[model samples]
Target: MHYFSQSFNYDHSWARVVIGMWHKYPNPHCSHVVTVDVVDRTVDPRTGIIRTERILGCKQRAPIWIVKLFGGSEDAFVREISFVDPSTQTTTISSVNLSLSQFATCNEMIRYSPAPGGRTAFHQTAEIETRMNMWRSAADKLENWLALRFEQNAQLGKVGFTDVLRQLWEDAKDKPAHVSA
Candidate 1:
C-alpha cells in the first residue's frame, strides 16, 4: 500500500521495467527479476529463440500490475508498485504480489476477488452488464495507477521503477500469481 526507497541515484541504466511472472521457482537465470526488455520474452515453438519486446519494461501505457491465473490453482497473486499514498514524488521500490487468495471458497473468492464486477449469470439475466461494470472498475483503476507510474518514471528517466522488491515469496508463491489489483 505504501512504499518508498532511497538507494536510487538518478542515472538509470535500463530503459523500461518489463516483468515476467512465472509459475516456477529456483530461477535458472541469475536474475530472479529480469530487466525490462533487458532480455526478450518470446518462446518459439520451433527454435526457442526468445526475443525481448521493446518498451517492455516501464512504459507509459503498460500495466504496472499483472494478474495471472494458472489452470490448476485457486489463489491470486497481485503484482503492483507500492507507492506512498498519492504524493507521486518518489515511488514504491519493488514489484510486490499482495497475496489475496485467502478467501474460503471459489464463489466466496469471486465475492472478494479483485476482478472487474460482471454479470455472474450472463445468459439468464440483465445484471451481466452490471457485473462487467465492476470488473471494468478494477481495470480502470489499475490503468490509472499504471499511467501515473509511467509518468513518474518518465520524469526520472528509465528505471523499471524506483524500488525493486521481493514480495512474491510470502503467501501466494505456490498459487497462480495475479498482478493486477
Candidate 2:
C-alpha cells in the first residue's frame, strides 16, 4: 500500500486559525474545486470526531449529499484530516493510504468504504472515529510544519486551475504524430 503522511506545528494559535479557516474553505484553491461544499461540519466536542452527516453551516452545492468523509487506503479507506485544539496549542494531521492495484482508479476512491460485508453504521462509526484521530494527529504536526515553512517563505499561495490544465497540455503537446489524439 502507498501512503502519504505529514505533520505541522503551528505557532501560537496558528493551528486554531488554520483549522477554522480550512473548515470554512476546505478547498483553498478553486482549481480542482468541484461543486464540493461542506454540507455539514458537526463534530464530537469531546473527541473532535465528526458526528453529524453534514455540518450545519457547510455550503455544499445542489445534490451530491453523498459526500466523502475520507478516502485512500488498501483496506477500505477512511483517511480523515483532523485538527486538535488543545488549551495551549492545536495540531492538524492529514494522511493518505492506498493499495497498489487501485492506482488508476484512485480518483474513484469514494467507493472504498468500510461498510464491507454489510457492516452497519453503528459498528463503523467508532472505527472511523478512531482512524480519524490517528490521521488527525499526524496531519496536525505535518500541517504545522508546512505552515511554518510557508510562513517563513511568505510567498506560498493557492495554486489555480489553469496551472493544472497548462501542465497537462504541455505534456500532451510533445506527443508523437503517430499517436495522434
Candidate 3:
C-alpha cells in the first residue's frame, strides 16, 4: 500500500469551500471527470447534518504499456461519500474507485474546516493499494509508479480546487443576502 497526505489553505469560508467541492468536477483543470451523479443526499433530522453519495466517471490517461495491456482504454468510476456538519463548520469526504478493484484501489479522504482568517484549511489523505495478480517484481514497480503519479495528481487537484473556490466566491458575492426574521 502507498500512502499520501497533503494540506492546503483556501482563502474562503468553509461553507464556500464545501460548495466549491460539489461543483468542482466540470472545471477545466478537471476535464478528465466526465460525469457526476448524486446517488443519495439526505439531512439527518436529529443532528441536522447532511450526507451525500456521488459517483464520478473519469477518463484518465495511462502509460503506453498500460494502454496496450488494457486494450487502449483507461476509464474508471469512483464513488464518494461525504458528511457535512454546518454547526461545526466541517465537511469530510471519502472516495474510492468502484471499478478495477482487482488491479488497484485508490482510497481518499478529505476534511475541511474553518481557519483563522475566514479561510478554510483542507487536509487530504490517501491510500493506494495494488491488488493485481502479477509477479512480485512487476507489482512492486507498478506500485512505485502509481505512488509518484498520485503525488503529481494531488498537486494538480489543489490548483483545480483553488480555481473552484474562486468561482464560488464570486458567485456568492453576487447573491443577495437573506435577512433573519
Candidate 4:
C-alpha cells in the first residue's frame, strides 16, 4: 500500500471553489478523461448539504505490455462521490477506479475548506494498494509502475483543477452582486 497527501490554496472563495469542482473535467491538462456522467444528485433539506455520484471514463496511456497484460485494455472507469456542506463551507470528494480491483485499487480523497482572505484551501490524499502473486516477478514490476503512474496523474489532475478554478474566478467576476450561491 502506498499513501500520499498534498495541500494547496486557491485564490477563490470556498463557494466558488465548490461550484467550480462540478465542471472540472474536460480541461486541457486532463485530456485522458473521455467522458463524465452524473449518476445521482440530491440536496438534504435539513442540513442543506449536496451529495453527488459521478462516473468518469478514462483512457490511460499505458505501455503496450501493460495493456496486453491487462487484456489489451486501456480504458478505466472511475466512480466519484462528493459531499458539499454550504453552512460549514466544506466539500469532500472521494474517487476510486471500479475496474481491475482484484489486482490493485487506487483511491483518492480531496477536501476543500474555507481559508483566510477569501481563499480556498485544497487538500488531497491518495492511496494505492497492490495485491500481487508472490511467485510472479512481473507483478512486482507492475506495482511499481502503477505507483509512478498514479503520482504523475495526481500532479496533472491538480493542474487541470487549477485551470478550472481560474475560469470560475473569472466567471464570478462577471456575475451580478445580487446573485447568491
Best by lDDT: 4
Error of 4 at 9 (Å): 0.6
Candidate 2 per-residue lDDT, tens place, 1-181, comes to 1222222222212322332333332334431222332333566667664422222121222212112222322122213344344442333333232221122111111101113332211100110112233356544443443234323222221233223323334445444312123
lDDT scores for all predictions? 0.26, 0.28, 0.80, 0.82
- lDDT string for model 4 (96-153, tens) is 8887676777899999998899899999998887676633666766667777888888
Q: Native-vs-model 2 lDDT?
A: 0.28
Summed over model 2, clashes come to 23
What is residue 159's positional error in candidate 2, in angstroms? 6.7
lDDT of 1 by residue, 14-59 (tens): 1111122222122332222233322224455655333332222211
lDDT of prediction 4: 0.82
- Candidate 4 lowest-lDDT run of ten: 172-181
**What RMSD does each model have against the real structure?**
20.0, 20.4, 3.4, 2.6
Alpha-carbon runs more than 4 Å astray in model 1 = 1-134, 158-181
- Tens-digit lDDT track of model 3 for 1-181: 8999988888887777877777787878777788999999999999989999999988887788765543436687889999999889889999987865667778999999999987899999999888857777656766776688778878878888888767656656655422122
For model 2, where is the 10-residue window of minimal lDDT?
A: 120-129
Candidate 4's C-alpha runs over 4 A off are: 132-136, 174-181
TM-score on alpha carbons, each prediction: 0.20, 0.27, 0.86, 0.89
Task: Check candidate 4 and list the clashing pairs.
Answer: none
